[model samples]
Target: MNRIAAPELDIRASADEAAPPLERPMRITILQGAFLPVPALMGGAVEKVWHEMGRQFAAAGHTVTHVSRSHPSLPAEEVVDGVRYLRVPGSDTPRSLAWLKVLDLFYTLRARKALPAADILVTNTFWAPLLLAGARHLGALVVSVQRMPKGQMRWYRKAACWHTVSSAVRDAILAEVPGTEEKIRVIPNPLPESQGSGDDGRLGAKEKVLLYAGRLHPEKGIELFLDALRVEAVRSVLVREGWRIEIVGPWSAAEGGGGESWMDRLRKHAEGLSVTFTGPVHDPALLRDYYQRAAIFVYPSLARTGETFGVAPLEAMAQGAVPVVSDLECFRDFIRDGVNGRIVRVEGESGVADLAEVLQKLMVDADERTRLAQAALAVRTSHAPERVAAMFLKDFALLSTLAVKVSH
Candidate 1:
């Protein structure tokens, strides 16, 4: 794909030359419980979104601070692409639930004191909303980024404003808390452009690779994907076509156990299959490399319990990989069947049959793959960092004007 440079914005200087007085940049702080440059803590899509938002805000002349739990491997305070990151020390509890609550309290207090006085406090997860509420009390405007369950609606309503990555999430938020329709805004997931040569030559020489890049668990429909692949016809067709499957993601204790035990079960069921489990590839650059090399991106998600937004597919699409997603609310907003990508409906027990059909057809037809891939590439440009940053700045400007009006 041909790369296009992001359009530069004009920023006015402060009214001083000799002294070069410091401009009062909009101080914006983002509160997330878990964020690290490593995969163990921060490989998730939410973390990627947070990082992108921070970079964009800083580029737009805002002093953005990202507050999250400290991983021992990372620096307590560091700057990545101009965004200041502060990682607070987490708790030592063994239990996941207890540790999460403990970390929440720890980071909240730490962030309150450490973060410079900000014009806006943007809380990413539901757990951090209480902290943002406190920030609001301290006279900072609060914008809650809803990415979790409806149970946290009370906290969301307390926010000065709300935004989410998808319309499904916004609807869920409104459903939980009435009269918040106006407060909620939808900004699609901002996926960084793939930084690789768009040479199909690299993929042409290798076996057709179908990539599933995300958490491997029940909600993500990994079992369903494997089950679908187990069908004799599907297996025979894929093997005959020399199509290899790769699953790249971290094992979550949240999905049961994180060790090889779960993987052993998957392997036992996937006997004689050409599947490679690459564990968790944390680096975004490496992940994008996989995206560029893969022939198709498949997301067979069925459950929405912990699935808020579909970021992987967007990233895959950005790299010109055609996405094959399950019929889910979040996916329906962007993926137009037969246009940008294909959507397989999940009905009854036939998990991979519909997906198998779609994949088989896409793998065989070169023209269809190229067309869809191009369309997918086009779709992602709208969600590029600069574009998403402009959307956010527009929203912030609107909110600021509204605040001034209300104050008078």
Candidate 2:
């Protein structure tokens, strides 16, 4: 397929730069999927990202409208934080992934009727790219590929641009559908300012807590984290030193988790460890409190294909917690092994032992932990919300200019 080459995007906007004039604003529409609400009350990563981005876009003098699922508490149509939100009747997340896609298709059909005219239509829904292919009045369709595509990219040929959060996702798409290099752009997620903000006293009073946030799924390597804690060396640190592990996030299959059976299995495995299973904390300000108090954060994800990006660990890093992650290509985009964070090779039977060793080392060495923690704080600026929003706006500007679709 022949494609129009993407224009060079300049996203060098800093804190000192002036905002765009209100008279010349881009009309932007963000369409979220069927499950979560706009304010991200239920803790969906994709929803939270676009929600924050929508607010930032609006603040930067763009006319923004965010269309999302309707919640009982939220109004059907209202403006919050400078962005307009339109909520459509939506369904709860079903058990099966296949069924979820079916619901997304139906929701897209419903949402299509409510969409307003815009210069750019940004969406991460399963069917929006294909469904809105002929929506010329809604302007350019910029699909946010937040996950690895399952042979869906070829059908989304009408998308003006594909925004991927990391090179890992971008490479996965290119591998699945060759000749799509020109239509893809890699933009890292921004660390919400709330996650990075806290008193310096919080950093100084970091506890001996190892934090693990995100869905309680098998692919997330929670089982591996449990197995590592079962190791005698790690158990010694937890028992003798009074160190504790906190496993946070939802565990139901409907909430993008591994199901209740998986959660039960994890609980059984963690019989004697100092592990606490704290459920999902949707509020960013409250989640930041957990990150601020933790001395270390671990995300030993084993999802080679399912894991697109690690947002939880990044938030923890912003709060000055030293991160120890699995050796995933997605994490390499931000985390440099032994510099800002530790990356453990968890590929084989020795994986548990490898993870245990890293945990034990960080648990004992306060100085080394502080060193990595300080360096990890740099993500505040690198992945700052303002900086990443600028990157997206740049791409949106370029794609809007080259709205003519070309394919062979």
Candidate 2 differs from the real structure by a C-alpha RMSD in angstroms, to one decimal, of 5.6
TM-scores of the candidates in the order shown: 0.85, 0.93
Model 1 clash pairs are none
Query: Over 4 Å off in model 1, which ranges?
Result: 1-24, 35-41, 91-99, 134-143, 146-148, 193-207, 252-259, 404-408
Off by over 4 Å in 2: 1-23, 194-199, 404-408
Candidate 2 clashing pairs?
Answer: none
Q: Residue 244 in model 2: shift from native, Å?
A: 0.9
Residue range 135-228, candidate 1, lDDT tens digits: 5433345554545554777655667677777667877877788787877788777775423324344334323788999877657777777777
| lDDT by residue (tens digit), candidate 2, 118-214 | 9899999989998898888897999999998889998898888899998889989999989989999998887766333333665688999999999
lDDT of 1 at 36: 39
Candidate 1 global Cα RMSD? 7.1
* Candidate with the greatest lDDT versus the true structure: 2
Cα RMSD of all models vs. native, in order, equals 7.1, 5.6
